[model samples]
Target: MNKDKVICPCRKLTKGDILKAVEQGASSYKEVKKATKAGSACGKCKKQIKKVTKKALKK
Candidate 1:
């Protein structure tokens, strides 16, 4: 994953941030949202967030 990639522009969250949340046991979109405040804004990044989480889980 791109370390500099900002997944949630609304909250200025990055891919690393999302992964951190995932590493912390956030296995779903809702759980990631609660952990990182991502996909909580305009909702544009929700899909990407889910994708990121899924990728992480696959590993």
Candidate 2:
């Protein structure tokens, strides 16, 4: 995925943001959400956030 791709439009968070959060110890969707507030708004990005979180953890 494009690192610049916006994963959470509600929070204007990009994929890079999530990856950085993962690098900073956010190992789960909930943790990522808490760290970056990515999916905390409309919640529509929950699925994408979870997907990114899982992918990041595998690395």
| Model 2 RMSD in angstroms | 0.6
lDDT per residue for candidate 1 within 1-59, as digits (tens), equals 58679999999999999899889999898999999999998999999999999998889
Best TM-score among the predictions, by candidate number: 2
Clash count list over all predictions: 0, 0
* Model 1 quality (TM-score): 0.94
Please give the range of 10 consecutive residues that has the lowest summed lDDT in model 2: 1-10
Query: Runs in model 2 with CA error above 4 Å?
Result: none
Query: Which pairs clash (backbone N, Cα, C closer than 3 Å) in model 1?
Result: none
| Residue-wise C-alpha lDDT for candidate 2, range 9-34, written one tens digit per residue | 98899999999999999999989999
User: TM-scores of all models?
Assistant: 0.94, 0.96
User: Residue 41 in candidate 2 has what lDDT?
Assistant: 89
Maximum-lDDT candidate? 2
